[model samples]
Target: MYSKFIINKDSFLGLAMNDIDKSSGNSLTTKYKNIVDSVLKEKFENNKYIDGSKIQSEWFPQVKCDIFLSHSHKDVKKAKQFAGWLKNKFGLEVFIDYNIWGNINDLLQNIDDTYCYDKLKGTYSYKKRNFTTSHVHMMLINALADMMDRTECLMFFETPNSIDLKKMTHSTESLTESPWIYNELFLSKILQNIQRRKKNELVKSQESVRLYADLNENFNPKYNVDISHLIDLSNDDLKNWLFHYKDNKHQNKPHSLDVLYNLKNINLK
Candidate 1:
């Protein structure tokens, strides 16, 4: 019953129509559908096709960052400084919530005001303000989710204001002042696990192919000639190859924390 959209490289154009599960009524799917519809209306007005195929568009949910820095509102200044350092030191784009939401303070203030006024007796305007605030929060959450998916990795800034060291040491789940940061951390971990699972599956498939090639039906000299090179490869060499293959497949990506630490120490060229 859990509905989700699985987008692959092949069928990008049919994204909107492909996953229309009416019974689930998932808001995330609806948001994606709306975005795709808007893009199609603006970009492909003439219904243009390239090489008898639908052209892939990459404008719906814009993601131009290699890393997403999830930090508390109190750490905006530090986040900005770190983002600048990353950009100059490694030529990497960093996405910070502060940049997206110009003034978090003001936004939070408005939400507080909406909540306070909503509790007033028979306030007609309270309903409208509450709806507006809810809509804005939903949009922000959806945007963050999309950015997490697109970014290579998510680096969480664990500051004193955000996390309580005492609680962290004693309890399994440490409470944070900023709930959004915790949400981002959970989503990022899930994404990483999913990616790792996919890579493992790909490795298993490759191993299966190698095994099949080794056990050939026809042992004739002509048939065995081509697979002779494969036969000579040792188990260690095959493992090394698979390791390299996975690295190559992922384009030698660095861990988020590792990249952050390297950026902090290295001098900008």
Candidate 2:
């Protein structure tokens, strides 16, 4: 769920990233625009998140699940079918991203001959309603917050296995990988509060990262950070930082030097 990137404004390649265990940082979906890659695509194909069919999984805890699927319109149909299956089988509520947003010609890009508006409409012809800009963004942020606030990442295992793994594996160490069916998680109820509080904190960190990025561009600050340290931060602190970073507008909040001093004195651990 966490990723550290050294982007050169071109592609995901060319970066020496750190692991979460050694660094104090948060998860990575790469960026708003570039969210996919061959490595990630391969992970999805391999279904690494799912336990083998024979492996007994504990009941999915936290009753009253309301799945919120956030994705480009290109992914709406898949999300809807997935949502419908879960709802019918388990009676769990599902909110596919399409139902919220409306007229997404702007939000989703990179489509021309391979895809078009009329074709996209046909794709969703069976479904009703689309997502609006405000609705989609707000819901996505809300859903992500919910997942992070909870103990588990609202998981679902979709890809059904052709055979049971327990029978195939004679030893504990050689079990096959099973893919997790679900995607995205709902977040905190006090999201508005957390959002505002974090907005004020992130400007500083964003400035730091941007500065680091710029330095990389001009070759200046000689950046160096271990991902393990960032990952080692408690979920709470790291999430707080994430929410702050997300609300980039709040970067201008004026925290007095004394306030920072007081914060430094407080035991974060």
Lowest summed-lDDT stretch of 10 residues in model 1?
Answer: 203-212
In order, the Cα lDDT scores of the candidates are 0.41, 0.27
How big is the positional error of residue 61 in model 2, measured in Å on the Cα after superposition? 22
Q: Write the per-residue lDDT of candidate 1 for residues 99-142, one digit (tens) a residue.
A: 43444335534544544354557443645555645544544455
Best by TM-score: 1
**Alpha-carbon runs more than 4 Å astray in model 1:** 1-62, 103-124, 192-269
> How high is the lDDT of residue 54 in model 1?
26
lDDT of 2 by residue, 1-269 (tens): 11111111122122222343112111111121123223222222343331223112211223222333333344334444444443333333543334323222333222221222356455532121122222323333333343332221122222112112332234321121211111121111222222222232311111101110111245532211111111122334323433443444655643221122232243211
lDDT top scorer: 1
Candidate 2: where are CA atoms >4 Å away?
1-65, 103-269
